[model samples]
Target: MKALSTALTLAMLAGLAGCVGQSGSAASAWYDGRDAIPPRGDRIYICHAFGCALKTPVDFAGRDIAALRRILAEGRGSPAAERRAIAKAVQWQERRVGKIVGSDKDVGGLDMQNAGVPGQMDCIDEASNTTSLLLVAEARGLLRHHRVESPVARGFFLDGRYPHATAVVRETASGTAFAVDSWPEANGVEPHIKPLAAWFNDYPS
Candidate 1:
């Protein structure tokens, strides 16, 4: 009877694996269909767990730039403070996205359960979304101290860590690089912003 139970458990596990694989395949197809355009002008494409939407959910358009500028103005005196402000602004926008998509209850970190479900973002979704937000901020002239850079990645299988990625930025004067990653936090929480070197060494908390 114990052996039979073990076999049943294995069957159930195999079934779950098949489901996950199918979900991942569908997600890949959806990702492939996305346009490579960056967010700009009065409208921005907000990406979430499922896919991208070209809607102004967050006040990231037009006069909202002033609000972003205000949030950023608080840290204008120092690079560290500016980065903190950027993180805070990003968190605020993330919360808005959460509400817009009705995905405010997503798990805090690395939620793989129901992997392709709408509103349940994975690292790819988070990184892409964060990069979009940075680009929009840069275009609006809201970022004074730093410039957006291409997204950086680490921890592929060869690195002995699970694959991960994050949005990156470079300070205009100091030329230091920083990673702005929001994947590990729950909705409405500030993202982790740290030096690129330290970010490379970080593991999910």
Candidate 2:
């Protein structure tokens, strides 16, 4: 719910930017009649790390949950299978938001490359509601498919602080750990494990 709230706030701000809106729906507003969301199986949710003043990832035009979940379920037993699942999840999320371009080999599109722009113009709205739900669903689905026994926390990086809902995965086995954020440097890219005090000393409770 905290993540959704953060996402909704971002979406409302983007809507105020005067570039996104449609039928009073944030999704319709951002797409502007373009039918370009990628396959559902590949979409991965991203959030803003610095603040909520970034563009949101457009939801690809025709993604269904079942399809998205199925695609995210790929990569059962390969080296970096978790990585593959992460990549595919991001692609699915990016495409759904209509941010991806052809042959990019990455999700979150130009935003992925820049790492600053949010996933969509209406990301906040979508995230708090549809997008966030989809992302969380995918994340859970991944755990189920991989038989991963660790808990994954989901939350938002707001104003350089991680707030709202978050999952902390504490398992001895090596599992994937990364932040899905608007900062170009962190777009589906995992960073070295540093002490929480190092990056978020002023983190909110």
Candidate 3:
């Protein structure tokens, strides 16, 4: 709904650049596909029900934001440490928001048993939600070593795999990219933070 055409156009260009897409509005467009309201300020749209087919708006109070700041403050040592804090923050957000959005029951990857139902999240949903969480942290100046980036997608239906996407971040010092993927973990579990290249090479398991 917000910049759908722009996202689609960027995705097309990313495919031409080299296989599907990588980081940026393409991921934002992924959310737009389901009419998600982008994360901004203290309000975020928690995406569930596969492909962000459903979005639940949750607002953070001052206490909630303070908790995030404290959680992230522990990672100021290095990029690697910050990544860990990021995973924790993402988990915290999931657990806290799950109560409101019901994603607490969400299993990693596709919850085939509950496809298109609330409490489940597919890659698209995971990627979009994770990206939103990262953006929230980044916007508040909690992240210093890395920056939230556009969501990245890999594998076409014909690329020996189904389409999949993940949230991404780039190291400010070295520009190294990493995949912040939570689709492989159950709700409230720490997400997998791996280099983007490695994530692309391996299956999204």
Writing each residue's lDDT as its tens digit, candidate 1 over 1-205 gives 9888567555434322221211210122223334324565645555665334332244455556776778888878888888999898888777766767655775667676746666776555666677777777777677888887766556644345555666777888998888888878877789889998898888642
User: What order do you get sorting by lDDT, best first?
Assistant: 3, 1, 2
User: Tens digit of lDDT per residue, candidate 3, span 1-205?
Assistant: 5587557555644533322354553346555555666887888888888767788889999999999999999999999999999999999999999879988888886457777888689877787788887788887888989987777777654445556677888999998999888888899999999999999887633
Most TM-score-accurate candidate: 3
Model 2 agreement with the true structure over 1-205: per-residue lDDT tens digits: 9988778767634433422211121233332222213113334333342123433343433445665567656755542454355445544544444434221223321232433333332223222222343335544454332221111122234454333211121112443332222222222332122222232342442
Worst 10 residues of 1 by lDDT: 18-27
Count: clashes, candidate 3 = 1
Off by over 4 Å in 3: 1-30
Worst 10 residues of 3 by lDDT: 12-21
TM-score of 1: 0.75
Please provide TM-scores, in order, for all candidate models, with all chains considered together. Answer: 0.75, 0.34, 0.85
Ranked by lDDT, the better of candidates 2 and 3 is: 3
- CA lDDT of 133 in candidate 1? 72
Question: TM-score ranking from best to worst?
Answer: 3, 1, 2
Give me candidate 3's TM-score against the actual structure.
Answer: 0.85
